[model samples]
Target: MSDQKDILKNLKTSSIDRRLSIAKASFLAGTRWATSNATSFFSSEKDKEKKRKQVLREQARYLVSEIGKLKGSIVKIGQMMALYGEHFLPREVTEELNTLNNQTIALDWDSIYPHLKNELGSKILDLEIDPNPIGTASLAQVHRAKRKSDNLDIVLKIQYPGVANAIDSDMNLFKQMLKLTHLLPQTREFDQWFEEVREMMHREVDYHLEAQTTQRFAHYLKDDSRYVVPTVIDDYCSSQVLCMTFESGISVNSPDVLTLSQERRNLIGEAALEIAVNELFVWGEMQTDPNFGNYLVRLAEKSDEQDQIVLLDFGAIRQFDKDLLSVAHDLILAGYDHDLDKMVLAMRGYSFFEQIPANIKPDMAKVFLIATEPFSSLKNNPDIPEGIMDEEDRYDWKLSHLHNRVMQRASKSMASRYFSIPPKEFMFISRKFIGAYTFMTVIDAKTNLRNMITRLN
Candidate 1:
C-alpha cells in the first residue's frame, strides 16, 4: 500500500511546477552566463568574439548536463534539439548537445526497485536481474535478467517512475521554453509539429504499445535473414516494464566493424539501404528514430565470416496514411525525372508550400531533386550531371553538398510567403531518411540505392 502511494506521489512530483522550475533554471543560467561574458574585458574584437563563443559552448554543456540529470522526456527533447533543432539553435548549442545523443544516465537500482516490484510483484523473486543496467534510454533503462522458470536469459526494460506523467509536463515546458527563447517559429504550423511530438512521446512511454509494435515489426522482417529482432516475453511485460529475449552484438560503427573487409562493409551498407526503402515504400511504416545505438552487427550463425544486423528499440514506429504515402511516391518519382512542375504540384498537394513565390518555385524543385540525389542513379536518368552520380552508381554525398543545399533552399523558401510546416508526419518521415543517409555517409558505404528502391515494389 505504501509502495502504491509512493508511486502516485512520485508521478505528482513530475508536475507542471517542476517542469517550469527546470525551464526557469535554464533561463537564469543563460542570462547569467551572457551577462558575465559580455561584461568581461577582451584584448581585441576577435578575442572578444572567441571568448563569447566559448561562453556559449560552456552554457550549452551545462544545459545538457542538467537535462541529463533530469532524466525523462526532457532528455529526449534535448536530443531532438541537438539533431533536428540545429537549424533554429546557435551552432555552439547544437554542437555541445550532440554529445548527449544516445547517452543515458541510469537511475540506481534501489531507486528503480519499487516500480519493478509494483509491476511484477512476487514474480520479481523468481527472476534474476542484474543490479546494473546494460543500457539506458530516455524513458527507460534496460537490464539483463534470467527467468527462473525456463532458465531463459532476457532483457528487462524498466521505465523511470514518473516518466509517463512527465511527458506532458516536460513537453509543455519545452514548448514554452522554445517560444521564450525563439528557438521555434511562433506559428500555428509549428504548434502542430509540437502536438505531434507530444503524441509520439505519450506513445513511446506506453511499454505495452512498444511491445506490440516490436512484435509487428518482428513479423514484418521475420523472413529476412539479414536482420534480427528479439522476441517479446509477454508474461512479464507491463505498461512500465518490458521483457524480451537477449541478443548481443557489436555496435554498428565499432572499430571492429571498420576493420572488416571492404566487401563485407558494402554488404552491410546495402542491407541498410534496402531496409529503409522497404520500410517507407512497401511496409508503409518506419522506426522513425535511427540512432546507431538502436542497431548492432553480429556474426552470422551459419557463416562465421558473414555478419547479420540486429535492430532494437521500436518505441518510435510510425505508420503512414495512404494519402501521405501517395504524396511521398509522387514526389520521389517527380524528383527522379527532375520535373519541376510535377514536383511542385506533388509538394504543394502535401502542404509543403502554402504560397511559394512563382520566381523561386523552380529553385525549390531543384532543391527537392538534389535531396533525391543520394537515392538516384544515372541508369534511371542518364542526363543527371556527372558530379551527382558516377558511372559506378555511387552517390557522392560530399561532392553534392546535400545538407548545405537543402538548408540554403529552405532559407530562401522561408523568406518567401511559402513558409508553412508540412504536417508533422512528413517531417518525422523525412527525419528517418536523413538519419539513414547520414549513417551511410559516415561509413563511406556505397550502394546503388536506386536498385534497392525497385526491390521495394
Candidate 2:
C-alpha cells in the first residue's frame, strides 16, 4: 500500500553484488538448518519429527525473506517456483515461498523518468504523464498518462532498467541459493521446470510480444459486450514500455460485485469461464497468470447496459501444442461422459499419463470426473452430492468444494511411486481452469455449464 517514493534509487543489476547477497543468505540459512538437525539428534522420536518440521518452516521463511529483499527476477523466480513447484518442493518450503511479496517497494519518479523518456522520446512531450506510479511490481511499474490533444487516458507499463538482461544470471544464482540451503532437490524434473521458469521470465519482460498478445485478445473479444480488452497504442509502445487505453473497473472480489443480483453474477461468471474454455479448445493459447490484479469487474451503470469483466496484462500467455490440446479435449469429453474407459483412452499420447500404472488409471479417471462435474448433468454423474445441483441443473461453485475433493481423490489413488511431475503444458492449462473455478466461486455463481461444454464438443 505504500506509495512510489525513493525506496530504491536503482535496482542492484550487478551480478557480483546479487550473487554475494544470495550466497550470504543461503549460507546463514544452511548453518541454521545444520544446527537444527544436530539438535534434533538428541530429541525423543516423536518430538524429533515435530521439531524438525518447525525448523524447516523457519529456515524456509528466512530464505524467502532474504529473497524478498532483492527485488528483481529472483523475486519473480521465487513466485514462479511457488506456483509450479508444488510437486517437487517440500510443502512447508513452498508455503513460505508463496509469501514472497509481489507488490515491491516502488522506485522514485526521478529514477524512473529517464527510462520513460528514453522509451517515449519526443512522444513524451505530447502527453501529461503522472509522476507517481499507479501500481508497482518487481520487474516494472505502471503510470497513468493523458494525451494533450484529445485528453485520452492511458496506462504505460514501464520495465525496470536492467531486469530483463539480468534474468539468466539471476536464475542461476537463485538455483545456487536453493542448493546451498539444501531446500530443493537436484533432478531432471527440477531442471526442466527451471528452464520453463526462465522462458516465462523472458517472455514477461518482452513488451512487443505482450502488446501483440493484448491486441490479439482484444480482437477476439471485440464482439463480446460482456468482456473488455484494452486497446493497444502502438505509437506509445516500445520494447521496454507497453501503452494501452485506460479501461476503468473495480476488483472482481469487491464488495460492490457481491451486491449484484444472482442473475447478473452468473452472467459475469460465465463470461469469465467462456474465455478459459475458448483459450483451451479454440485458440490453444492461454493467459497463464491469473493474479486478481490482472482482472477487473466493470459494473453497468444503467439498466440497458451489461456488466463487463475487463481483462488486463497479457504477458504470461502460454501457447499449447496441437497434440496436447487434442489430448486435453479428449479428457474433458471423457470426463463429461463419466466413462472410465474413455478417460483412460484420453490419457494416451501424454508422457506423464503413460507413466501411470495401468491399475491406478481408473482412480485417476475418477479424479477427472470430479473436476469436470460442473459440466456434467445429474443424469450423467449420479454420484454428485445432494444439494450441490439445483432443480434447474445449475452447479453452485461456492457449495461444490470441488477443488478439495479432487485433491483428496488424487492423493488417495496415486501411490508415491506412481505420482510424477506433470508436463509443463498441463500445469499451465490446469492452473487456468483452477483460476476460472476460483472466479466463479468468488462471485457465488450458480451456472449450468453443460450446454457450454457440449457446444465446445
Candidate 3:
C-alpha cells in the first residue's frame, strides 16, 4: 500500500472539476509564457532565444505536473500525445509530457471496492479479491483473485469509475490546455492524430471490446506452445471489471531471464519477434502498447517443457487496413532484397512517404535496409557490421546496434522540413518493432532473422 497521501481517494471525475483544474493550469502556464516573452523583448537575440526555450520548458513542466495531479484520462491523453505527438507538439512540451508516468498512484481499495461490488454484484462473492492492486495504470488497476469454488487463480481488471464517461470532456479540455500553452500546432495532421488518440482512449476503457480482443488473441495462439494469453472469465466480467485467469511469470527483463542460457534466450527473443511479424503479416491486429510490463516470461519447470511468454493487456490492439498492411509488407520484402528501387516504390503507397522529396527517398530506403539488416542475407546486405552475424546466419542483436544506426541514417536523411510524421498506422507498427528490438537487445539474444522473415513470407 502506498502512503495515504500518495493513494488517491477518488478521481476528479466531474466535468466541472476537471475543466477547472485544467483551466487553472493552462492559464498559469500561458501567463508565465507571455510574461517571459514580454520580459525577453529587451534582451539580445541570442539571449532571447535561449530564455524563450527555458521558459517554454518551465511552462511545459508546470502543465504536466498539473495533469499528473488529475490522475485519470487526461493524464493518459498527455502520455499518448507524448508518444505520438513528436511531429506536432513542441519539443519542450513533448519532453515534459513524456515524464507523465503510466503507473500512477493507485486508487485506495475503499474507493475501488465499492465500484467492483456494484459491477459484479453478488457474483463478487465467488472470488477472494485482493484489495491491493498488483498493477495500476491511468485507466485501471488489476488485482489478483482466486475463485472460491475451485480455487482457480485469476485477475480482475477494475476500471476507474467514471473514466469512460469522462473521455470526451477530458480530451477536449486537454486540447484547450495545449492551445492555451501554445505548445501544439494547429494543423490537419494534429487534428487527425488527436482524434486517433481520442478513439484509442475510448477503446482502452471498453471492457467488452477488450474482452473480445483477449479471447480472439487467445484463440489465435491456442496452438502456439511458446505463448500464453489469459482466458477471460465471463461470469465475473462487467462494463467496469474484466476477469481472466492470472497467468504468472517473471518480468521480461528479470535477472532470472538474464541468467538463462544463450539458446534459451534466443528462443524467447525469436518468439517475441515472430509475434510482431505475425501481427503485421498474418493476424492484421497488434497489441500496440509495447511497454515492458505488458510481457512476462514463464520459465519451464520440467526439462522437456518449453518456456512460455505470458502476454498481458489487450487494451491497445490496433487493426490495420489491408492496403496499409500490403504496403508495409512490400517495404519489408524490399528491405530483405536490398533493392532500393523496390523500397522507394513501396513508399509511394503511403501519403506520408509522398511528402518525402525524390532525392531523400534513397536515403530513407537505406534506413529501411539498415532496419531490416537482420532479415537480409549477408550477400544482399553489405552494411551489417562485421562479426555481428555468425556462420549460421544468426544476427547478434546486442552487438548490431541496429536502432542507433537506423536513427542516425534517418536523422541524416530526413533533416529539416523533409521529415514527416509517418501515417499513424505506420507509427504503431514501427513502435511495435522497436519494442521487439529493445526486448531482443535487453536479452542479448541472437537468432536467424532470415528464417523468421522467410516463414512470414
Candidate 4:
C-alpha cells in the first residue's frame, strides 16, 4: 500500500506540473484575446466593434471551459473573482468564472468506498448513511447518517478524494497567473497573500484543521446560548471525513421575515451584530464568508421569539492583525463622534498610507461617515434630533449610495485600490460585519446604535 501511494504521489506530481503548464497556456491565450480585442477597438481595425465583441466572447468560452477543467485553488480563485463581480473584472468574465465554483465532479463510491472502509473499517454497513449526498460544495459535502451504537443522527462532511492534490496543482497555476497578469495587488508587504491562501486551502482540504478551527470557535462562544457553532466528533473524524452532530435550522432569506415578529427578527439582527463586533474588536478571530447560507435561525427549545442563531461552515477563517484592528475600532468611533480631523488622522493611519492630497482628505472623512451605516443615517445633522431605529425602516439610501461611490472610485483606481485589500485575517471579520448589518437592515429594528458604537470607547 505504501508503494502504491508512492507511485500515486509520483503520478500526482507529474499531473500537477502538466496542469500548471496547461493553466499557463490558458492564461497566455487569454492575454492574447485581451490584447487583440483592445487593439482592434483602439486602432479602428476592420469590423472593429463586431470583431472585438466576438474576441471577448471567444475568450469567455475558452476561459470558462479551461477554468472548469481545473479544480482546487485556481478554480476557487476564479470563483471569488466571479463573486467579486464588476468590482474586479468585467461582467462577462465574472459570469464565466462563477460556474467554476460548484462545477467539480463528485467522487463515486468506487473511489470514496476505500476511504469509508478505512475510516469505519469492515463495519461500515452496520452504520447508516444515505448514499446520495445531502449537500455538495467546492471541497467537501455532507451526508445524513445515523450511528449504530445509539442511533445518533449526524452530518458527515466528506472531503473530496483528490481535492488536495488538485488544489496544490491549481493554486500553483493561480500564483503563476497572478505574477504574469498582475491581477493580484501590487504591494510587496501583501505578496504572501497567495502563499497564505495556499496554506489555508491546504488546511481546508484536511479535515483535522477544519475540525480544530470549528472546535476553537465553538469554545469561544460556548457561554453564549444566543449563538451556536457545530461540535466536532473526534472519534469519527479522519483526515478526509468529518462527522458533526446534526443541526436543523432554516435560513432567513424569505420575505416571510416580514411575518416574523419584528421584535424577534430584530433580536436575530442584534445578536448577529453583537457577535460580529465582539469577534472583530475583542477576539480577533472570525469566519469571513458572508454567504447567507452560513446563518440559520432556530426556534428556541421552550419558546418562539426566543431562538438561537445557528452558524454553519468554518472553512475560511481569518484572524485580525492587532494594530490594524485597533485602528479600525478607533476610526469607527471617531467617525461616529463627528470629529473630522480625528477621523481623518484615524482613516489615513488605518489605511496604512502616510500621505494623501489635501483635497481628498475631507472627502475621505465624509466617505468614512457615509460608509458607517448607522451613523450615516444621522447625516451629520445635529438639529434633526436622533430617533429610535425602526426595524422596517432600517435600509439607508445614504449608506448604499456612499458604498456605490466608493466602489466606483475603487474600481477605477489602479494605484490606491491595491492598498485596500485587508490582511486576510480581517476578511471574515468584514464579512461578519456586512452580514450582520444587512440582516439588521432587513428587520428594521431600532437600537441606540450610538450606544453600540460607544462601547468601543
Strongest candidate by TM-score: 2
Instruction: Report the alpha-carbon TM-score of model 3 versus the true structure.
Output: 0.95
Tens-digit lDDT track for model 1 on 1-457? 1233222123224576566666776686657665756677655888887877777777677766766666678777777667665435678888877887745556767778888999998888889999778887777888899989888999999988877877887887766655544344666665666676778888888888899988988998899888989999998898899999999898877888877776677678888877777787888988888789889988655555468889888988888987788778777877665567877787665545545665677766766776776666776565455676668887755456566667676667633334233456766777887877776666666666766655433
Which of candidates 2 and 3 reaches a greater lDDT? 3
3 or 4, which is superior by TM-score? 3
CA RMSD of all predictions? 5.2, 1.6, 1.8, 6.2
Q: How close is candidate 4 to the true structure, as a TM-score?
A: 0.78
Q: So what's the TM-score on candidate 1?
A: 0.84
lDDT of each prediction vs. the true structure? 0.73, 0.87, 0.88, 0.62
* Cα TM-score per model: 0.84, 0.96, 0.95, 0.78
The residue-by-residue lDDT of candidate 2 on 218-333, one tens digit each, is: 98888889999999999999999999999999999999998899999998988888888899898889999887888999999999999999998999999998999999889888
Q: Give candidate 1 misplaced runs (Cα > 4 Å).
A: 1-24, 30-59, 176-185, 301-306, 338-342, 382-401, 408-423, 455-457
263-379, model 4: which lDDT tens digit per residue? 677667667777677767777866666666677778665664377788887776667788778777877777676667877777555444345665666565655554564542354
- Show the colliding residue pairs in model 3: none
Q: Which has the greatest lDDT?
A: 3
lDDT of 3 by residue, 1-457 (tens): 6578868988899999999999999998889888988988899999998997898899889888888888889888988888778778778888998888644689999998999999999999989998988898888899999999999999999999998999999999999988898886878888999999999999999999999999999999999999999999999999989999999999999999999999999999989988888988999999988888889999999999999999998999999989888888888888788888989898886777777788878878877888888787777777678999887878898898888887777777753344467678878887888888889999999988787667657
> Against the true structure, candidate 2 has what lDDT?
0.87
